[model samples]
Target: MAWNTLTCAALARNASRRLHHRALSTHPNPRPYTFHIGASWAGKPNEPHQRPKVPWPADGLIGSWRDRTLARPNRTTTSKDAGEDFFFIQEMRNQSILEGVSFGVADGVGGWVDSGVDPSLFSQALMYHSHRYSRNAWAGEPEIDPTLDYEEREQIEGWEMTPYECLDLAYGGVLREKFVQAGSSTACIISLNASSGLLRSANLGDSGFLIIRSSAVHYRQRAQTHFFNCPKQLTKLPANSGRRFSRACIDSPSEADVFETKLRDGDIVIAYTDGLSDNVFPSEMVTICSLVARAGGTEEEQVQAIADRIVEYARQCMKNKNRVSPFERDAARQGMFFRGGKPDDVTVVVAIVHETS
Candidate 1:
C-alpha cells in the first residue's frame, strides 16, 4: 500500500508547537480539557453532547486523568488517510455513585478512506456513543444491595450492560443517516467506580488499556488482531446496492474482552492504541509508567508528561526503522524471527488513583 507524505512538516511543526504551548495550572481543581491529532470532522462535530466546562483537577486518587495522541511521524494531518484516531473522557456529576469516570481510545482503520468516508468519523462516533452509554448505563442501574459481599459487589457493579452493548450503541451512532459511507474502527473503553474502587474495561480491537502499580504491570489488555495490519473491528453493513467490501469485514461487533480490577492509591492506569502498544514492548511501558509515577510534580503535570513521553517514544520508533518492536522481540524470544516497528496513529490516556486503601 502506498502512503502519502504529509505537507505538515507543517503538521509535525504544529504538533511540536501545541506541546510547548500547553498551559500549566497549579490550582487543585484545574480545568478539564480534551484534544486530538489527525483530521477533525468535516461537518458538525460527531462528538457526544458536550457538558458544561467546570473547574476540575486532572488528578486525584478517586479519579484523575489526562490524555494525548499524535499522527505517525512524518504524516500530514491534511491527508485523508493520516492518523485516524480519537479519544474521550467523560467526567461524572458531583454525586454519581454508579459511574465516576469513563475513558476510551479508538483507531479508525485506514482502508475505509478510499470509500469516500473519513475513517476518523467512524472512530470518533464510536467513542462518543461509548462515552454516552457508559454514563447512562450507570445512571440506570438498580441501587446497590448492601447485603452483597465483596465478590458479589464487584460482579454486580459492572453487570448493568455488557461491553458488546456499548459497542452496538456506538455502531448505531456510526450508521446514522448523516453519515453515509461505510467504515469501521477498533475501540477500547475503561470506566471507574471511584466509591467502590472498581475499574472496568472492555475492548473490540488492538487498542488496549493497562494498570500499573509499584513500577510493575498490574494488568494490560491483549491485542486482538487477525494478523498484522488487520485488527478485529466493528464494521459497517453494505448498502442494499450490494457493493463489495473488504473480506475482512465481518459486519458485526467484534467480541469485547472485559476486565475488572480494584485500584489502590497511586496505581496508574494507561490506555493506548496500537501505534504505542505495537511499537513499544510491555517492559518499556512499565518503565515509562514508573518514571511518571516517581516524577516530581503535581499529579496533573506528571500525567501530561507521561502522555508526551510515550508519544515521543512511538515517534522515535517510527523514525528508526531498524528498531525491532516488542512484537518482534517476543517472536524471537519464542524461537521465531520477526522485526521492525509499525508507523501509525498513537493515542494514550494516563489516570492516577488518588484514594488510599
Candidate 2:
C-alpha cells in the first residue's frame, strides 16, 4: 500500500487475466465430445438436520446448462448440510448433444456460525452465482443465439470465459447478495472445453479435483493453506464483527491456483472437498474406482457407480474409529493427536471424458 507495489505475482496475474478474457474462436462446434457426469454428496452424521443417510441421486440425474433450474438458489436442501459443504454439476449444450461441461464444489467455513451467519448463505449463494455467472461473466464477441432476447444476449456477450474470471465474477455476485452479509468458503471449479480437449481450473482453499488415467492419478491438486489446519479461503467479513472474525483468512479468486491441462479420452476427473481428501488417500481412490472399472458399463452408469463408491468409502471411514484417516495422519504430522476420521460434509463430482469418432 505504501508504494503501490507491483510484484512478480501481480504482473503474472495481470497477464493471465488478459489471456482469460480474450475472445473465443469465431467458429464454434456444438459437439466435439460428450461427457458422462454424475455427483454424490452427504452430511456428516454428527451434523444436525441430516437424514439418516443420503441416498445416491437417480441414475438419469443428468442436467442441461440451459436448464433454468441451475440458475436458481439451492432451496432443495436444508441449510445444515450446505452450511457445511455444497456442489454443482451441469452440462453445456448449444443445439446438439454435448458441447462442454462446467462443474465445481464449495465448502462453507463453519467458523461463520460463531458470527451468526448461516454459512450456506455464502457458499450456496457463491455457487448459485457461480453457476449463474457463466451468465455472470465477461462480455465477449460471439455465440449468442439469434433467438435470445436483447437482455439475455447482453448478459452473455458471446465469448469463452476463463475459470479465473468465472470465480472472480461469482465472488462479486456473492458480495452483491444482500442476504449473504458475511461468510467465507473454499472453492474449486472447472471449465472443460470439450471441442478442443482443454481443461482449465481455478481452485482456492483446499477443495479440489484429481484426474485419473489408466487406473492411476494423472493429476491432483495439492491443498493450499496458510498453516497446518487453515487452508486458503474466499471470505467476506461484517465490519461490526471484524475484530471477532479477525483470524479468518480472506482470499480473492485472483489468488486462486489456476491450472490448465489437455484431457484425453477415458480420463476420469473427480472433484471434491476436503471431507473426501481428509478421509481417503490417492492410492485408495484408485483402488476404489478400480471396482467400477472392472465392472464397466456405459459412461453414465460407470460415472454414477464411481461417485457412489467414493462417497460411501468416505462415509464409512468417518465412522470407523479404528481406521486411521488422512486427516488423522496430517494431524499427527502437525503434532496434534487426533484419532480416526474428521467428520464433515462430503461432496464428490465425477466426469468421464469421451471423444466422438
Candidate 3:
C-alpha cells in the first residue's frame, strides 16, 4: 500500500495544535472543584467504519468530555476495510463534592487475526456500560467521610461497593446480551475523590490506566494479553462456560486494583487505550504532565495539551525510527502501532486532578 504522507501530516498537525490550546488555557476557579474529564480517538483503516456513538453528558463542575475520531489507511485487500484505532475519555461526576473519577478505554483492531471481536463494538460497550455502572455505584453508596486521609478513606468507601461487581453485572447482563455473543474486550477505569484525596481504579484487559503523582508514575493493568489467548485468571472464571472467553476470564480483582492512590494538590490521572501507552514511555508521560503543570492551565486544558504532545511525540518517533534502540523497540512498537505503511488506530484521554485550598 502506498503511504499517504499528506494525510499523516494533517493528522499530526491537528493533534499538535490541539495540545497547544489545551496547554495554554487559564486556570478556572479551583474551589473544591467537582471533576474534569477529556477524551480523544483515532481509527484504524482496516476496521469497520463505525463512528463513536456515546453521549457526552454535562454534569456539575466537570467540563464536557470532548471527542475526536480520525481515519487511517487500510491494511488489507478486501472490500471490508479496517480503520484507525479509537481512543476516548469519559470524566464522570465525583459522587460527592469530595471525590471524582475519570477513565479512558481503547479497543484493539478487530481486523487482525485472533483480534477476537470488532473493537468498535467492544470499546463502545465497555465505555458505555462502565460509565453507567460508576454512576449507579456512586448513587447507591453513602456519603464519604471528609475527614479521613484521601487514600485511606477511598479504601474504606470503595470496599462498601464493588465497581468490578458492578462491571460484572453490567457485562453479564445487557452488555453481554448485545456484544458478548460476538466477543469481548479489554477495559480499564480510574476514579478520584478530591475532598478525600483518594483515587480508585480498575481494569479487565490490555487497555491500561496510570496515575502520575508528584513526578512519580504508577501503572495499572486491567487484563493480561497472551500471544493468542486471554489471561489465565480470566479463562478460569465460572463465566468461561463455552464462551469466547479469550479476554474476559481474567476478572479484575475488584476495582481497588485499578483505583488506588491519594491526590496531592497537583496529581494527574490518565486513563487511555493501548494506542497511546503503547507508543509513549512512562518517563515521557511524566515529562508531559510536568510540562503541563509548570505551564499552568486548567486541569482540562493541561490534559488536552499533554494528550496533543503525546500524539506529536508518536509522529516524531515514527520519523526517527533509526534512532530508536532494540531495547526501546517494545516501547516504540506502541507508538508505531499507529503509524507506518499500515497503522492501527490511536486514542488518548488525560485527566489532571488538583486540590482546592
lDDT of 2 by residue, 328-356 (tens): 89989999998998888788788888765
Query: What TM-score would every model get versus the actual structure?
Result: 0.68, 0.77, 0.61
Task: Note the Cα lDDT for every prediction shown.
Answer: 0.58, 0.68, 0.46
lDDT of 1: 0.58
Candidate 1 residue-wise lDDT, 77-133, digit = tens: 233222467776664433333235667788888777555566765676677666655
Sorted on TM-score, highest at the top, how do the candidates line up?
A: 2, 1, 3
Summarize candidate 3's per-residue lDDT along 22-80 as a digit string, tens digits: 11114342335344554444444334555334322334111122222222221112322
TM-score between candidate 2 and the true structure: 0.77
Please tell me which predicted candidate would have the highest TM-score against the true structure: 2
Better of 1 and 3 by lDDT: 1
Candidate 1 segments whose C-alpha is farther than 4 A from its true place:
1-82, 94-99, 135-164, 241-243, 327-339
Name the TM-score of candidate 3: 0.61
Q: Which prediction has more favorable lDDT, 2 or 3?
A: 2
